[model samples]
Target: MKCEYDKDTESLKIELSEEIDMSTCKTLRNIMDGYIIKYSPKECVLDLEKVNFMDSSGLGLIMGRYNLIKMMNSKMTILNPGDYIKKILGMTELAKDVKII
Candidate 1:
């Protein structure tokens, strides 16, 4: 997985290119936390368009970020998720939590 943070928009855009499994989850979490704290953006965008697969761990990441951003009076958005990821998001009932635009 590759992550990038845009300090200007306060948007942490994570480009997940592979499966979001246990091993990658740790790296992702660490990177995301760093960006969130460094930029302190009012919004976050997770770009899942390149992601092929994701498990519950991925869901947990999204939820965690959502909670963190909420506390800061910010917002989180998921952008261009593939079909598989979309299903998982829907099943997890997070469609409304993030924008899919």
Candidate 2:
């Protein structure tokens, strides 16, 4: 995962790749959490265009970030997730807290 922060826009965008599973979720979570705590962006976006697979741990990551940003009165969005990811997200309560576009 790669994270970019735009100070002018107050946006933090996370680029996720390949898979978000046990092997990568911890690193992904650390990267995302650290960025959020440091920048506290007004907008946080998870870009899932390159992710082909994700497990329940990925859902936890998504939900945790959603809650974190929400508590800070910020917005969190998920972008470019494929159909599979969309279906996974749709089945979860995390969808209620995250905006996917």
Candidate number achieving the greatest TM-score relative to the actual structure: 2
Reference-based lDDT, residue 47, model 2? 96
Ten contiguous residues minimizing lDDT sum, candidate 2: 18-27
Model 1 per-residue lDDT tens digits across residues 1-101 = 56677767767776767688887888888878777777778888888888777898988988887888888888888888778778888886677767877
Instruction: Give one digit per residue, the lDDT tens place, for model 2 in 21-96.
Output: 8888888888889999999999999999998889788888898889899999999999998888888899988888
Clashing pairs in 2: none
TM-score per prediction, in order, is 0.85, 0.93
What local lDDT score does residue 80 receive in model 1, on the 0 to 100 scale?
Answer: 88
lDDT for each candidate structure: 0.79, 0.89
Superposition error at 22 for model 1 (Å): 1.5
Which sections of candidate 1 miss by over 4 Å?
Answer: 1-8
TM-score of 2: 0.93
